[model samples]
Each structure stands twice: as C-alpha cells, then as structure tokens.
Target: MESALLLAPKLVSNPSREFRSNVRQFQSSFCGKSIAIVEFTRTDAYTNHKSISKITSLFSLGKKKVKTIKRETVIPDPDYRIPIVLLGFAGGLVYGDNLLAAAPVGLLGLLLLFQTTRVKFVFDDEALEVKVGEELDESGENVFVGGKNRWKYSSFVNWELWWPNFPILVYFKETQTKPEGQIHFFPVIFNGKQLYDVMVERAGPSKTSGPN
Candidate 1:
C-alpha cells in the first residue's frame, strides 16, 4: 500500500511537469512572433521614409531656378537747366512787351519745370523706360497719340545729343515704336553725362560725336 501511494504521487507530478513545459514553449513562440512583427513594421516604415526622401530630392533636382535681372536707373539725378532757361526766356519775352508769346512760353516753361521734378529715365539690360516720382513708378502712357514710354536699345536706329557742350535736347529714332521707325525728341532734363554714357554703351555710338 505504501509503494502504491508513492507511485500515484509520481504519476500526478509527471503530468503537472509536462503541462508546465508546454505552457513555457507556447509563451516563447508567441514572444518570438511579436518581436518579428515589431521589427518588420519598423523596417517597412524606414524604407518608405527613405523612398519619400529620394523622390523629394529628385523633384528638387529637376526644377530649374529662374534668374531675375535687375533694372538700373540711368538718370539718377534731374537737370532743371532746360526748364529754368525756358522760364528765363519767357520772362524776357514778357519784358519785351510780347504778351502773346510770353503767355505760351511761360505756360510751356511751367509744364517743363513740373515734368523735371517728376520724370525719371531708367535702364534695364534690354530696354530704356521712363518712370515718375522718387519711387520710380511707371510714367503711364505717352502724351503723343500713338507712343509708348519704353524702347529697346536694339531697336534704336540712331540717337543724338544736341549741343553736347551744353546739351539742350536729345533725339532718337527707334523701329520698336514704329516698324517704319519713329522719331522722338526730349529736353535734356536729366544728368547729361550719365544719359550720354548709357546711350553709347547700350544703343551703340551715336552718329554725332559727344563732348570730348
């Protein structure tokens, strides 16, 4: 009876040991699967991130950057000589008892003087443009019926600065304004030296020689 009791206890202990071993095996397998799933998720995320970065880099490389050319002021300072001379002439006319002539001359002088304060000449790499005010804003449409305030240097057929020693007037003909070519005349109300220099440089040498 004692031996039988001992044998029964051993049988019960063996089954309990087997069940514990099985539970340990199942836990180890589940833990390994969980680790593998976590590793795969991280690797996939890393791969996707790398791919996105490469695509972004390729797009950046493909896009071309545009170059912007800056416009420069050719006539930085204004010349009031033309307007002052006109006004002086008008005053002389008035003194000479020529009221009829004086009225028009005085009006013209006033207009020119006002223009001298507002008008500006600006030059870009390709063209010459007229601007207004200290801020260099567009001068709007030309006073002439069919004319623009801008002209390309390439389109200039010829240009001249009259009385170079004491520049009073500037004249230029350009095909851009008219295919047949258009003649333009403007008073020298800007820095004559700078104007002549820029014109020679951009539009090529004028037919007439400038100041020595």
Candidate 2:
C-alpha cells in the first residue's frame, strides 16, 4: 500500500511540473515582446524630438536680422566766425567813438556768440533739423510765421550760400512752411564747409557755387 501511494504522487508531480514550465515559457515570451515594443516607442519619440529641434533651429537661422541706425549730427563742432566778425565790427565802432551804435552791435555780437554755443545742426537720413545744447534738445516752434524747425529736403525750392569763399549767410526757400514757399535766412554760424556740403548732398546742388 505504501509503494502504491508513492507511485501515485510521482505521476501527479510530473504533470504539475510540465504545466508550470509551459506557463513560464509563455510569460517570458510575452515579457520580451512588451519590452521590444516599449523600446521602439521610446526610440521613435526621441527621433521625432530631435527632428523638431533641428527644424526649429533652421527656421531661426533663416530669419533676417534687423539693423539699428543712429541719428547723425552734421555740426559736431560749432564755428564762431559770424559772432567774431560782429564783435570785431563792434570794437571798431567803439574805437570810432560811436557809443550808441557800438552798444547795440556789441549786444548783438554777444547774443550771436551765445547762440553759437547752444545751437546744433543735426542731420538724419531724410531731413535737416535744428537741435540745441549738448543734449540735442528740441528747438521748439519756428520764429517764422508757419512751420516747425524741422524741414524736409523734398520741400526745398532753392537754396544758396553767399560768397562761397567766405560764406557769411545761408538762404533757402521751402514750401513746407507755406505753399507759396517761404524764404528763410540764417547766418553761417556753424562750419561753413560742412554745412555747404551737407546742404548740397541733401537739398541738391544750388544755382550758387559752394565754398572751395
């Protein structure tokens, strides 16, 4: 009876072992497939991310870079010839014993000298403007009837510099101030050569010759 019992247990154990072995084989194959699928999904996502980044970089490189330009001042250094001449004339009048005439002339000379120290002629790409002081402050309203201090070169009707060799005055007519064209005159208190050159370059050549 003992031997028969032992034989029965051995037969049952054999079937259980085979069943376990088959289950293990199925689990191992399923796990291996799942691992392969996960790896492929990760690789695809990584490749897609890399491609997107590369395309974004290329687009950034294709964009145009904008350049910033600064406004240029035409008269960096002021000229005092007009004021000096006036002062010299006033001195001559004083020497001639004309106190009344010398008084006014001397005041005018002083006024012009003060103006020269403060006034600046600034030029940008399109227009000529009057700025004041080292800070280049706005010159405010025009002393003339109708217009701002700023004037477009396109509006100029005609311009001239007197006595090209010794420019003492600058005259320009522009329709910007009035449709009939208002005449404007300024003493050449700034660098005459630079002023003439810039005027010709921007406002075009005048009927009068420029300083040599």
Candidate 3:
C-alpha cells in the first residue's frame, strides 16, 4: 500500500521533483496526530485517496490513560550525536559550487555537535542500556545501561524512529511509576503495550510487576 502511494505520483504524470509536494499534501492530516498510534492494516482503496489514505492513525487512548504516561525528557550532552550523522546524511553543501565548498565548516560543525550528543537508550535481546554520550566502550561506563527489568527480551517490541532534528519528544521517566524511576529528556525509541504483548511471546517469563 505504501509503495503504491509513493508510485502514484509517477502514475499521475508528475515528475520526481514534485514527489515532495505530493507527499506533503498527503501528510497534511496525519501530521497533526499527536500521541496517535500508527499501524498498517489492509488498505481501503476507495476511502484512501489522499495519497496516504491506507495507513491508519489511532488516537484511541483517553486523557487519563495518556496522562499516566508522563515522564521527564532530557539528554546528556546531545551535541556528540551530531558529528556521526553529518558524516552520513549530507546532501548539498558538500557538492555545491566551489564558492560554497569553501564555506566555513564552523556552521556544519556546530550543527553536528548538536546531533551526535544525547542520552543513549538501547534495548536488545540482552540488556537495556542508558547513559550520557555513546558508550562505545561498554566496559567502564557509568550507569549506561539499566539492568533487566521484569520486561522480556523481544524484538517485537519495536520502537518509533524520529527525524532527530525535529524529534518526537517523549517525556517519560524510566519506570515512570516503577521502582527504578528516573527522569529523562532525550531522543529514544519506545513501543507501547500492544508491542509489549508481542515481546512477551518471544522473551519468555521476563514479565515482572509494574505499579500501573
């Protein structure tokens, strides 16, 4: 369904240059869906005309339900994360005319400084780690990773990825109401209950108790 939507512009005789415009038009309504859960289900060809009609956004939680999920949002030295990204995602500045090529790197350096630094969060089959800056050397880092929670180790508990520049700011404390409660403000990925259910299927007996 998503592939068809992306290909629709070409079918409409629109040039590749106009693809962004087409996507922007489709993103209009869905862009405002704050705290909405997006899922891919069967595409409704008829009701789905607005370029992006197939994907669904579920704003199903009540105010109180949503309120229970609050937590602090912070990242330590967020600038460190920037350098790594600038090395990877640049498009124009490096290839523009000679005059622009000579452009002072100060601006780019500052921009990347903001990108590469932040509180890090990683959840894999083994452990869930958190810390300030990238702990490339996991041997002697500060509380870089919070030990195993009652939560299981399932990859099915996928997280939402954000365009870090305009990150989806998730303000929730670790354990929020759980014992290991700690405040945070940084770019991290998260998957809610339904995802946890999927994780439980794979992680086996990892569930502990939460204050809910």
Candidate 4:
C-alpha cells in the first residue's frame, strides 16, 4: 500500500526542466509514505509484542530455578511525524516557482525536517543508550550502530525531574570544574516508566543542591 502510494507520483507528468522540483516531489512522496509506514508498523509492532509476551509468559510458567529477568522497553521517537507531514504538505504547495506559497512552506518544512531526524531510546541494565537513525533487532534488542549517546549509571548527578512540561536536568559532576559546573538537559519526551526507574537506580542520589 505504501509503495504504491509513493510510486504513484512517478506517473504524474512533469514537463519542466527544474530537476530540483522533481527531487522535492520525490522526497515529499517518500516522507508521506514513511508516515503511513510508521503508523502501520507501530500498530503492528504493539499487537505482535503483546501476543508474543503472552506466549512467552505461558511457556515460562514452571521454571525450576529463580532468576532475575532484565526488562527492556522500546519507545519510538515520534518527533519526526509532524515534521515529515509538514514537509510533504509544503511539497504539495510548491507549484512551479510559486514563491508566495512555496517559500514559507519550504523554509518551515526545512526547519521541521531538521527537528525530525530519527531518534530512539534503548534502556538496559547498564546504561541508557540513545540511538539515532536506527531501530531494534529481530530479538528486540537495540542495534548498536555508529552514533549512540550512552549515559552510564554514574554519569550524571542532581537527578531532577520536573512537571508536565519539563526536561530532565542532570548535572555532569565529572565535567564540573572549580569555577562552573556542566549541566545536561534531556527532554522528557523520550522518558517512560521503566526508563525513569532505571535512570534513578543508576544515578543513585543527587549530589548537588540543584542544576546550579
């Protein structure tokens, strides 16, 4: 379904010499198709995960020895959805150099696209790894690619979690100098129940009074 929708644009006749325009059209089609795929895959993954979890629980009912099972939760970074939609909408507005409509749309779309770059959060026993532009493996493990921002359990201090609209502010005591201290702001959007608990457990106690 998504492939057909994406390729459907190729059938539209373009009698213009502007190669950039054609590229933009192609990209817009790609983004639109991606949104469709993300929505479908998200729903499918959730359903499959639930079914698999039930089966696993039933199979593991009568285990002999006691063991500690590490929990893993995969949360899709949904920041890209809005930007991709905006860009696709902008591409729709572009009708052969119609700057009046296209210019603002294109600029706004560019900004949104910048914000929409893929990001995923992987939480495990040792560290909280942030994987950008990568997904999970077949066994539901984070595919450790090149770009990964990992925060070890002992990396930050002053674990302050704020209200409804706030980011997790943690101080990197390791980076603190005699004059000033370094603070890192992690957006709360990537946070979940398990992830939060793991972070707190790893971080232990807050050393500093505040982000100061």
Best by TM-score: 2
Comparing 2 and 3 on lDDT, the stronger one: 2
Candidate 2 lDDT, 99-183, residue by residue in tens: 8899988998999899999988887777888889999999998976645688888998889988688887888888888898878
Give a tens-digit lDDT track for model 1, residues 127-188.
99888998989877788836669999999988999878888888888888789888888888
TM-score of each: 0.62, 0.63, 0.23, 0.35
Badly placed stretches (over 4 Å) of model 3 are: 1-120, 131-135, 139-165, 176-180, 188-212
Mind giving the per-residue lDDT tens digits that candidate 4 earns over 1-212?
99999876764443321121111111224323311111111113333331111111112222366698865554534444445555677777775656578778778767656534555556666665665555543223324322235555545545555432333322334222212433555444343444445555666755545555
- Winner on lDDT between 3 and 4 is 4
lDDT of each: 0.74, 0.72, 0.37, 0.46
Error of 4 at 50 (Å): 72
Give the runs in model 4 whose Cα sits over 4 Å from its true position.
1-68, 73-117, 136-148, 166-182, 187-198, 201-210
Error (Å) of candidate 1 at residue 6 is 75
Q: Candidate 1: worst 10 consecutive residues by lDDT?
A: 50-59
Candidate order (lDDT): 1, 2, 4, 3
**Top candidate (lDDT):** 1
lDDT of 3 at 210: 21
Score candidate 2 by TM-score against the native. 0.63
TM-score of structure candidate 4: 0.35
